[model samples]
Target: MTASSIEIRRLTAADAAVYRDIRLEALRLSPEAFGSAFETESVQPVGWFAQRLDGGAAILGAFRGGELVGIVGLMVADGPKRQHKGTLVGMYVRQAARRVGAGRRLVDAALDLAAQSVELVQLIVVDGNDPALRLYQSAGFVEYGLERHALKIDGRYYDDILMAKDLVGRA
Candidate 1:
């Protein structure tokens, strides 16, 4: 994404095509990073995305020249204990979009949106993604704990650190 031309906006049902493209790209290139696979989601019905947006999930897309370059998903739960918390997931920025502030903007959008109904936001990062870890930290996320060998990718186990950020001014 270009420095001055990138736009960060809420993703709508009409942006499902762009969403699918970015999602598939993530799963294909970084299959170990996420819980789902391209083979599984690549064939899913389009209604899946439409229903997702129609529901309560919040999505943000970073677009440059009308092309989606990054995306983040925020899901707010309804339970008493979890109502004040939002979980961050499905965060990805295109390879071409790296180093251009696109990732930070996408994350900032998610964090800002989470502040509406959630007093805190939570996410997990594969320990090896140094840049992402730094970005999350810069955005006020702190490591709380690590899940030992949480993911088994390609016959190897990788640990992930749980991170949380408290939203200030929330009662």
Candidate 2:
């Protein structure tokens, strides 16, 4: 399918099944890109995924022809001190959907939601992931730091590039 044919929308509890499928696929295909392990999430019940939909987070999915093909998650911080902060996570686009603008649409949706309430949106991308870094950069996210050993999988460590974008202004 073409990029413009894909539709992006917020996910609800009813979407647990499809969400789980794409999520597991992401974790399996790119283990270094996320903090969650496929082995841990692969066994979770659909109810567990459903429950996640009710939190202080927004999960956006890209669908083409009614089939979910991509997803990105945004989480707003709780507590008075952290209320203006939001975090981006779980960004993934299916191999077939790459270079089709699904990732950009997903990020734009997340940013739109975040702009309503948060002052800043932050995300961690694995080092050397040029495509994702480029996406975030094009979306106005600037790298502010890097965390060494941000994730350890199968006895190997992967560093994470910390990037953030100010919603009120591009600072």
Candidate 3:
């Protein structure tokens, strides 16, 4: 799968299982990039995923012939001062779909949604995810900061780099 063979759409309750599956895969593949681990999320019940289906956040999914292949999440920052921002998380594309534009499409939808409800969009990427970092940069996201030793996985400390893009106005 490539973007040419895929279609992007907002996720609904019916997609909860697929969402869970993809997210679990992401955590398993890159334990450093995500805050949650497979050991932790595997314990969550289906209702937990179900309850997240429709909420303040916008969940985007990429599908190829009705099979979901990519997903990205958008959630509002909670607080008065930072309420104008949206946090992008749980972003992942299947291995076969990596080189294609599926990931870009997923993020584009998330950014568009963020632009509507928030003025800025932010995300945290693991320091070594160069391909993803480049993609985000190409999409107008800029590295803002880094949380040193932000994540610990497999007994190694890793830094999480924060990146953001201003959507309401310009970059």
Candidate 4:
């Protein structure tokens, strides 16, 4: 499906079930791309995911024909010194929905939400994910650092590339 047929919107507590399904799918399909483990999140209560949409973080989803097909999250800092920053997280587009602009729309939606209260938005992409790397670059995120052994999955280590985007003009 193409992007034009999908609607981008912020998720709510009512969407917890669908969100949980997609999130777990992402962690299971791409273990190296996220910090959260499917083993841990999959067992969490549905209310846990609902609370995530209630206030703690802003999660955006891409819907096609009323079905949630993609998602991305933005968490704003709460500390005194870090309140002006936000972290981009949990980005995933189902295999069937990829390459039709769902990923880009999700990132753009996250950035749009972050721009409301943050000066900068940051994210960590697992090294060697060229498609994700290119998507971030196209959305104006620039790599700032690299962390070796950022994640260890199945006894294998993977690096992470830290990236950030200044929201000067967008804000």
lDDT per residue as tens, model 1, 1-171: 356788999888888877888889998987767878788999977778777766788888999888999988999988897798899988898998998899898888888788877888999888898988999999889999999898887789888889999996743
Tell me the spans in candidate 3 whose CA falls farther than 4 Å from its real position: none
Quote the lDDT for 93 in model 2: 95
* Model 4 C-alpha lDDT per residue in residues 1-171, reported as the tens digit of each score: 888898999999999999999999999999999999999999999899999889788899999999999998899999999999999999999999989999998998888888889999999999999999999999999999999999998899999999999998873
In Å, residue 48's CA in model 3 sits off its true spot by 1.5
TM-score of 4: 0.96
Estimate the lDDT of model 4: 0.93
Q: For each candidate, what TM-score against the reference? A: 0.93, 0.96, 0.93, 0.96
Instruction: Quote the lDDT for 69 in model 3.
Output: 87
What does candidate 3's lDDT look like per residue over 85-128, in tens digits?
A: 89998898888788889999888888877877799899999999
Give model 1's clash tally.
0
Q: How far does residue 168 in candidate 3 sit from its true spot (Å)? A: 3.1
Give the residue spans of candidate 4 off by over 4 A.
none
> Any runs in candidate 2 off by more than 4 Å, and if so which?
none
Cα RMSD of all models vs. native, in order, equals: 1.8, 1.5, 1.6, 1.1
Best-matching candidate per lDDT: 4
| lDDT (Cα, 0-100) at 87 in candidate 4 | 96
Q: Worst lDDT window (10 residues) for model 2?
A: 50-59
How far out, in Å, is residue 137 in model 4? Answer: 0.3
Number of backbone-clashing residue pairs for each candidate, in the order shown: 0, 0, 0, 0
